[model samples]
Target: MTILITGANRGIGQALAELYQDRGETVIGTHRAPDAGHLRELDVTDPSSHAALAERLGDTSLELLVCNAGVNLDQGQALDDGYPPAMWEDCFAANVTGVFLTIQSFLPHLRRSDAPKIAIIGSQLGSQTIASGGGYIYCASKAAVLNLGRNLAVDLAPEGFAVGVYHPGWVRTDMGGDRADISMQESAQGLAARFTALNPETTGCFETWDGQAHAY
Candidate 1:
């Protein structure tokens, strides 16, 4: 299968891309850094970047597209301490709007595939039903991505596409920090398994890497 992943220079995204590559799958890994040796340059927040990415991967029908690029505003203070609007904006732009733009740009290529699947990496903290309410900006952005995936699943089902929202658990990456519970390899493996198991009938569901349904 041919797969495309965003923010693939490091962390979970890098691990996922490497995992797919090891399985003999063609991987188009994107990152903002030009020096990202094996990854293509892409900045999801930029429209031009999306266009360029589409051109770069021209005519390659993708079986899977993983929207793994994300950012968390470390506004560690309480929301009452005046939430950093700039951080919120950046988080939303990267985590939510970026997903929309990436999907829009790549939809045509994805349509050409016989089994197209899109998976957006979300967070368990985004679950409204299970939310304890911290990291407000990041939580809100992830929640938006979850809904985006759901809506996309509904809209794309007629075209034989499947969309899923997944939480990678607290992985030990730069974003997850050193205190996280799981390793990046473990998270990527779990996510890959979920991606492989998804079907049109299971679209619109939020799940974890381990196959458990997430609280919406």
Candidate 2:
């Protein structure tokens, strides 16, 4: 399977790319940094970058498009910080708008394949049912992604596409911090396994990497 992953220079995205490559799948990893050793430079926030990447990819059909790029700027901020509107805008640009643009740009390539799956990397904090509080910007951005995934699933159903919005849990990555619950390898593997298990029938579901259903 040919898989296209964004934010592939580090964290879960990098791990996912490496794991898929190891499994003998064709992996096209994208990052914004031109110096990324194993990934091609791709700025999802820029339409020109997406157009260039599409041109580079040519006729390579994509079975899966993983929207794994994201950011969290409200990490250590207290509620007293007033949820920096700038940070919220940046987070939305990176986490929500980026996903939409990436999928839109890659839709033609995705349609070329017999099986097309779109996975948006979401977070548990995005779950409104479980949200008692808020990380403010980060939570709201991911929540937007979750909603996007749901609507996209419905919109793309007639075209024979499957969509999954998943939370990888608290993974030990730069963004997840050093005290996270699981290692990047473990989280990537679990997500990969879950992705492999999904079929067209389960298209619009949101779940954890470990197969637990996420509350909408």
Candidate 3:
């Protein structure tokens, strides 16, 4: 299967790419600025970059598209001086707009697959039911992308596409911090299973890394 993962330079995205490659799947891991590695350069916020990537792939059928690229700019911002206008714009650009543009640009490649799937890496904090009142920009962006995934699922179902939004848990990554609940390996394995289990029936689901249904 041809799987393309955005923001695969580090953290969960990198782990997912490595896992898929280990399974002998064709993995196209993309980063905003790649070094001397196998990862491709792709700035998800730029539509022109997406076009360039598509042109490079040349009709490659993508079985899975993982919109894992995101940012958490309002991590410890104070309510007084935190979450400024520019920060909001930057966070949304990477977290929401990037995901949407990627899906839009890759629709053709995804359509070529018999069972195309889209996995959006959302967060539990995005859920209205689980809101804890911090990281407003990041949470709102995630909520927007979650809604985007659900609507996309509805729109793409007839075309044999399954879209799922997921919360990868409090993993021990740069974003998740060292005090997080789980390791990258554990989260990656569970998420791989979730991606594998995604189908027509499970489309539009908001799920956790460990296979539990998440409240919207």
Candidate 4:
């Protein structure tokens, strides 16, 4: 299977790429940085870049497309600091709009495949049931993607496609920091398994690393 992962030059995306490669799958990893050892250049926030990537892969079939590229622009900002307006813009641009654009740009490639799946990397913080606030922008962005993924599942289901939203767990990555609970390996492995299990029946499911269906 051929898989495309965004922001795969580092963090959980990097680990996921490595895992898929080791499994003998063709992994196309994208990065915005030219020298970031990416297999291709893609800035998820840029529509032009997505178009360029679509042109580059003209007719190649893509079995899986993981929308893992995201940003937590308001990471450590205090409520007193008041979430900057620009930070919210940047966060949603990468975390929400980016995911949608990537999937839209790659639809043709996915349609060419026998089995196509879209895996969105969302967050547990996005769960309305678990209102663990703090990072408001991150939570909002993730929640939006979760909604997007769920709606995509509904729209794509009749077309023999699967769309799943996943929580990679609080992993020790650049975004998650060293204090996170899980390692990249664990999260990547669990996510890979979850992705494999995703089908039309589970298309609209919001699941965690360990395969637990999470509350939205």
Candidate 5:
């Protein structure tokens, strides 16, 4: 199977890429930085960058595409003036628009495969039932992307494609921080299983890393 993961230079994306590669699959790890060593260049926030990456891949068949690139600009912001206009723009651009653009640009490649799957790395914070408090921008962006994944699943189901939105556990990554709930290995393993289990019957599911269905 051929898998494409965005923001694979570090964090959960890197762990997922490494896991797939070790399983002898063709893993295409993409990073925004030019000096990302073995990873390919892909700025998820830029449509031109997605186009360039797609062109570079030519007719390569992609079995799985993981939209893991995102940003949390409003992390500890106050309810006052802490969340600026630019913060919202940048957060949504990377977390929501970037995911949509990546999927749109890679549809052809995905169509080349017999069984294509899309995994969106969303957050539990995005769940309306679990809306805690802080990180408003991140929550909103994730919620938007979750909706995107659900709609894409509906639209792509007839084409033999499945889309699953996942809340990778609070992992020990740069994004999740050191005091998180689970380790990167655990999250990656659980997510891999979730992705593998995704099928047309369960296309628009919002699930957790441990394979449990999350509240939409």
Candidate 6:
């Protein structure tokens, strides 16, 4: 199976890409930084870049498309700063709009696969039932992506594609920090299991890396 992942230069995205590659799958890792070793350069924040990536792939069939590119702009921001208007713009741009654009631009490639699947890296924080505090921008952006993935599942189902939203767990990465609960390997393995089990029967599921259903 051939899989494409965004923001795979580092963090959980990198771990997932490496996991697939080790398992003998064709894994394409896309990154924003040109100097990111073997990862291809593709800025998820740029719509034109998505178009370019699609054109470059040119009808190449994709088995899985993982939208793991996202930003946590409001990390440690002060409430006194009122969430910083510009940060809100950047947060939504990278986290929400970027996911939608990636899915939209890659629809043709997805259609080429007999059993295409989309895995959106969302968060438990995105759940309205679980939400209870700060990081407003990050929370809101994740919520939006969760909603987007759910709706995309509905729209793309007739084409034999399945969409699943997942929380990668609090993995120890740059984004998750050292104090996080799980290691990158653990998250990657659990997520791989989740992805393998995703099918038309469970297309619109919002789940965790460890396989539990999530409230969203």
lDDT of each: 0.90, 0.90, 0.93, 0.92, 0.92, 0.91
Residue-wise C-alpha lDDT for candidate 6, range 32-115, written one tens digit per residue: 867355577788889888888889888689999999999897888788867888999999999999999999988898888899
Predicted structure 6, TM vs. truth: 0.97
lDDT of 1: 0.90
Which candidate should be chosen as best, given lDDT against the real structure?
3
What is the C-alpha RMSD, rounded to one decimal, of candidate 4?
1.1
Local lDDT at 169 for model 4: 96
TM-scores for the candidates: 0.96, 0.96, 0.98, 0.97, 0.98, 0.97
- The 10-residue segment of model 6 with minimum total lDDT is 32-41
Better of 1 and 4 by lDDT: 4
Q: What does candidate 5 score on TM?
A: 0.98
The regions of model 2 sitting more than 4 angstroms off are: 35-37
Which residue segments of model 6 deviate by more than 4 Å?
Answer: 35-38
Q: Model 5: runs farther than 4 Å from truth?
A: 35-37
Higher-scoring candidate on lDDT, 5 or 6: 5
Residue pairs with backbone overlap in model 1: none
lDDT by residue (tens digit), candidate 4, 80-164: 8779999999999999999999999999999998889999999988889888768999998988999999999999998999999
Superposed Cα deviation of residue 112, candidate 1 (Å): 1.1
CA RMSD of all predictions: 1.2, 1.2, 0.9, 1.1, 0.9, 1.2
In model 1, what is the error at residue 116, expressed in angstroms?
0.4
